[model samples]
Target: MQANTVEQIAEVQRKYEELQQQFRAEAAEREAAAAAATREVEQRKKYDELQLQLQQMIQMF
Candidate 1:
């Protein structure tokens, strides 16, 4: 009976470790996606500014 109990405890610990690892991987993936989205937003802002400047220059001609 004691041996069975020990085995069960070990199994539980192993599962806990696996879950922790999975959570870490998911968090990292989310962080990377957020960073990419931020970069895209910055790029769009720059593009819009450039477009506005081009329009203004054309109007002066």
Candidate 2:
């Protein structure tokens, strides 16, 4: 009975470690995706500003 209990405890610990690793990986992926989205938003803003400037210049002509 004692051996069985030890085996069960070991199994739970292994599962817990696996879950922790999976959670860490998922967190990293989420962070990377958020960073990419931020970059895209910044690029879009720059493009819009350039377009406005071009329109203004054309109007002066």
Candidate 3:
């Protein structure tokens, strides 16, 4: 009976480790996606500013 208990504890520990690793991986992916979105937004803002300047120049001509 003691041996069976030990086996069960070991199995639980293994599963716990697996879940911890998966959580960490998901967190990292989420962080990377957020960073990418931030960069995209910044690029879009710059592009819009440039477009506005171009339109002003066209009106001057």
lDDT for each candidate structure: 1.00, 1.00, 1.00
* True-structure Cα RMSD, model 1: 1.0
Per-candidate TM-scores read 0.88, 0.89, 0.86
Screening candidate 1 with a backbone cut-off below 3 angstroms (N, C-alpha, C), the clashing residue pairs are: none
Model 2 CA deviation exceeding 4 Å by range: none
User: What is the clash count for each candidate, in the order shown?
Assistant: 0, 0, 0
Question: What pairs collide in candidate 2?
Answer: none
Candidate 3: regions farther than 4 A off: none
What is the C-alpha lDDT profile of model 2 across 1-61, one tens digit per residue?
9999999999999999999999999999999999999999999999999999999999999
Best by TM-score: 2
Taking all chains together, the TM-score of candidate 1 against the true structure is 0.88
Residue 49 error, candidate 2, Å: 0.7
Worst 10 residues of 2 by lDDT: 1-10
> What lDDT tens digits, residue by residue, belong to model 1 across residues 1-61?
9999999999999999999999999999999999999999999999999999999999999
Please state the error at residue 43 of candidate 2 in Å: 0.4
The 10-residue segment of model 3 with minimum total lDDT is 1-10
